[model samples]
Target: MIDGAAKSRKAQVHRMRRIFLFTLLSTFAISAQNKEKPTVQATPAPYEWPAEKDKKYQISSTFGESRIDHFHNGIDLPGEGSKVLAPKDGRVLYRINSEFTPGEMPYGGGNTLILDHGDGSNATWSGYMHLKTFADAVIKNAPIAKGEKLGTSGNTGHSGGPHLHFFIYHPGERAMLNPLLFLNDLYYRDTKPPEAKEWGVLLADKFANVNPDKPFRLSADYPVYIFLQDHGVGKERWGVFEYKVRLDEKEVISTKFDRIFFKEGAWSLATGHKFEDIFYRNLYALTPQVRRAKKVSVEAKDLKGNAFSKTFELKIQQN
Candidate 1:
């Protein structure tokens, strides 16, 4: 078995070329290489989950979710049959099967496929990666129907188990759109809201939890963080969809996670908020670090339109 360190390096070396080629095609636009003129979807969107809906499954991740350094570009769906299917009617633009390759699939995105669901200049590519094998029907530039099996899910890359990493890419927008925004037609829904537990202040480059009811000594303006938690249909924590912070009755920060922008080799939200600016030490979703404040309040919402809020009363603590 490959150890942790080896597993990482294995991915870097084996999948570098594959990733580059995939990015190249996706970057320019997968529709460019279509064998025939790309067709448009009859409906609004293929929005169907990338796997067998009737099969036992769970969404392990959400769109625009946070990662170590970059944000999650797509949703993670893990389920039975390993049946990877087409989210909508589209032409198979490309396919990759790492099993035929000699080394581990790098970038942890193994055995992938790209499908163009719209005509050129209006193309939206559905990404299905890390599959066990490609379905016979997933032919290059061949038309595929919604829910049609494209491949079997597999631990093709540096994966721990079998699951599917599905994503949506719009070439025109040059942004990663949130898959959940258009997937409300599904039988499953997430009504759970975000939970805000404790409030903390980031002072002197350190995070310290504090009770809103008690007095906290403060010298100057410092970043404040809130320990917030959110979940989907499952128990796994999902990031909030949007957030707004208020200080002394003035709106300080308002941001949403509807989409992610990749610019200058970095990930950011709307208004150019970096990962660190939005998340404090990767523990808090919003860091209200504006300035000296006597009152502060926070409001947040999850992807399902669930809302949550909390207000704090700060009494200046003297040293």
Candidate 2:
């Protein structure tokens, strides 16, 4: 009887040990599963128009447009003395008041206001530039409501005319995003396709202009360049949404200028190349072997989904 009772106690100890091991493994499995899952970012609230009671506001220039040296950083709404409203409810992160300085030109954005919408991990910021004047209540770190009048549009800094330069950015990444994605496009009317005006080849630092209707000969290696533009409802010309380059029916370079990515804490063009190397960000370099191709094609699309294509005949120049 004593031996039998001892055996029974040993069996109970074995069962307890097995249960403990199973529980430990189950907890670890649950923890691992949770760790492998990704955190989903909450959806952001829709943004309102920045202009007050305005339906005829036009986008003079668009984001990612090729400028003289650098890409245009924001969208331009051409108007004078128009009220600039807050796009969303947020707090003023900071403001640059360059209007008081005499004989000093406001280089980039003359007078600018930055607002932060702290939405936890999906926080975003908006920048209003070239303001004529700020409201009395718009102070640094002050809370602002959507549709509130922040300031008046003006030609305060580096602006050719009175306009509001609006841009949206990710606060954490400090990268500029397309504001058109947030704003409602139904308010405006635009259905024009992007136009491919000119195509040329850069050889030995000289542009060998090519007529798309005629075949051009190029013996040495050269990079192709495209001059394209888009128009909205009015005669306002903007930038194309995306573009592609093809040689001998093979796609070589394709780019979509939807978002201007950031690198080294500064904005970069969507060329996949260094900003300094490609100042225009509209040039497509070709390999030496591919330069001998007999055909080249260029295509572009606008923000409204309108598309355009142009083909050029090429010939290898005999040395």
Candidate 1 backbone collisions, by pair: 15-106, 110-130
Off by over 4 Å in 2: 1-43, 269-290, 316-318
Cα-based TM-score, every candidate: 0.79, 0.79
Q: Every model's Cα RMSD, please?
A: 5.9, 21.6
TM-score, structure 2 vs. true:
0.79
Minimal lDDT window, size 10, model 2: 31-40
Give one digit per residue, the lDDT tens place, for model 1 in 133-192.
888878788999888889888766655567787777766555567777766446456778
Give residue 300's error in model 1 in angstroms.
1.3
**Candidate 2 lDDT, tens digit per residue, 1-319?**
1135655554444344324323432342332233222323324576788887645778888877755434566688888889999989999977878766565432356788888887865777788878999998899999999999999999986667999998876644434677787787765656888876665676786666666566567666666566687887667678877777788899876776666655543455455544433334343334344467777777878877888887777655636
**How does residue 48 of candidate 1 score in lDDT?**
78
